[model samples]
Target: MLPQFFPPFADAVSLPESPASSSLGKALELLDLFSLTSPLVRIDDVIARFGFPRSTAYRYLKELCDAGLLAPASGGAYSLGPRVIEFERLLELTDPLYRAGQQVLQEIGDPGAVYLLHNLYRDKVLCIYKQGPDVIEYEGRRITVRRARGLPFPLFQGAGSLALLPWLSPHRIRQTYLRNAAEIASSGLGDDWEAFRRVLAAIRRKGYSTSQGTITPFLGGIAVPVLLPEDRKLVGSLAWTVAAGAMTEERVESCAEHLTRAAQAIAREYVKVAADM
Candidate 1:
């Protein structure tokens, strides 16, 4: 929402407006500058760029950090902290897509062993929503979801990654690919641009991807894209990891069908929720 100082022209013409003091406004503006692509920021950078007084900015920053909204980075920088991660987890837990998918996942075979993976713009697979299964037994093999954070896999290599790639703007997709190019190529995405482009093109054509040898060994990924109804934008990917030994060609087909259906159901829920807003 626009602040009173930046009131709509129509409102400004008709209403007597009292603009906020510069310091308060600048503090809020500083927070807005942090984003996925640039998460870490320095206090001096914020003050110089946003024109907030150093004292005023530090007061705000100190409160924000003490309240767990932000945290001090190494060398005294600041970044979004544990509180925001907690809030995001709360949102995902409450999200209708997550809730509906949870129920559907339960109804399908082997609910105790099933888990769901979702991807968002910044952190890739936002987190795993595990219903149960401290250790999954699939085809007589065990798998576990331990340490959900800091698992970095290319946004191009897994089904969740490929599912997200087509939804991003061409510029953003290219930027992300380049950002992780050297590391992703180590996973055999390809060594150079031409080869990487070919891989991305194939993912677009195939409409999904099956990535083996991604984050967890002996676990294969199956992903499908979910389209937001409002603008038909691809929001994120829905994927699950299946034990590789259990993923015969037939099981792979089943996974695709099941995951696609779940994606559609979740997308439908997202549309309804968005419309309510």
Candidate 2:
């Protein structure tokens, strides 16, 4: 479960013991139902599918809506809201590094899917870009960004998240990773610490990371960390996605190289911005 402290609503529901009272799970499931495929959903649909009490369903939806996590559609249906969009914008524009990275992303391909930078805020990775469709083919599949803006994801689920690992101090990394490790491991991720350590170490050495079949079953992700040239601390990462069928070691490597160069260029720009400051 995503920790509530990261987002106040994450922990609002109460779960029961016997047969798993399932209130919390149901609430989360309800939110998952409103993804790109079903962006606009009705409360009645949630009620009908989950068999949640009308009062209970409304209560959770109201809370989400109030928090700006959800918005009312025509006919009282629900969709994602502007709050997430605003937050994502703030995350990008507030950081000179990310703004620079966005520019690099725009220039990298022949109108391909672009990228945005993200940080692990409140335990979830938050997106800050408005990307369009771009494609790279491998193994009979395509790689591209699924959508733009306000896409919240688990930090343990992709190349971008791994990129953030090397920039943290060993102490901070141990603490933060340990705290979230159990939750991450239990959340259907591989339970191998050794493997995670290797992945992070490889990212550190290579200056980029790639993962397939992690966040989305048939999608691949490639990412590189933005580092302070002087201190080399990880600020965030620039990333894009690929379809599972398009995943190939060679394609992943190509993406990694390009993303690293872009990240370095952005880092250079950020350094100049800081120097001016």
Candidate 3:
């Protein structure tokens, strides 16, 4: 993996009941507990969640606090620490894709659309950077980008998420399809493997993906894969969302044209930045 770059994708797989992981890995996993519903965690929460022994749980908490990933909170609990903000700053400054995205977004310059930059993290799709229109809301409607950094969407959902499907290796694609066949069908990809392959093949040929209200009601998305110019390595995606009713065939084609141009520019910028590093 390249230092200061986005981490690569992981396979869609499940963990065993008592699988072995390093102490550091387990400590970092504690960050997953800090979500919308559970913003803080106590020692007992850690113990109950992971079945870690009392002493081991305390030790892990200490390690996390020392690392600046977690900090003590009111009433003997822990919350995500200030270091996460620092890391976000670091990413905005140094990450090639983000730096590139900033440039491409301003270049697009269209209002009433929710712009997004997505990257594959672990087994799910993550919206790393999101920006709503600055000038006005979408025709008197407020557009919200649904996928947050902490809350990831599945591989088979949304245009932004599904846009990444064609870029994965065949083996990984097969693995994901097998693991999520029901979801694939529900998303209208196909119930069977052959149909799933065909649908993705068409998406790969067209070089973008679009969906209407599949993930959010009355919303639609158009996404194009971003790849390294030289090696064609999949970086992530550049996508935008707008009112579902506005997406006629001509409109989608026009939107796709604009998105493809932006994605190519971002990919070229990423390549140049990577070379400089």
Best model number under TM-score: 3
What would the per-residue lDDT of candidate 3 be over residues 1-277, giving only the tens digit for each residue?
A: 2211212334555433322387777887877788779989999998888999999999999888887888999999999888888998998888898888877787767655677888887668888777665222456775555655445788788888878988887666766776778988988898886777778878888889999887777788899999888888899988888788788899999999988988999999888787787
Lowest summed lDDT across 10 adjacent residues in model 1 is found at 2-11
What shift in Å separates residue 127 of candidate 1 from its native position after superposition? Answer: 2.0
lDDT (C-alpha, whole model) for all candidates? 0.65, 0.68, 0.79
Which should have the higher TM-score, number 1 or number 2? Answer: 1
Give every collision pair in model 1.
none
User: For residues 45-104, could you state the per-residue lDDT of candidate 2 as single tens digits?
Assistant: 888887878899998888878878789989888888889888766755566765666676
**What lDDT score goes with residue 17 in model 3?**
35
Which should have the higher lDDT, number 1 or number 2? 2
Q: Using Cα atoms with residue i matched to residue i, what is each candidate's TM-score against the true structure?
A: 0.65, 0.60, 0.85
- Candidate 1, residues 172-228, lDDT tens digits: the string is 555555567786688677797556666666766666678765666777778888776
lDDT at residue 49 of model 2 (Cα atoms):
82
Q: By lDDT, who's the top model here?
A: 3
Candidate 3's displacement at residue 86, Å, is 1.3
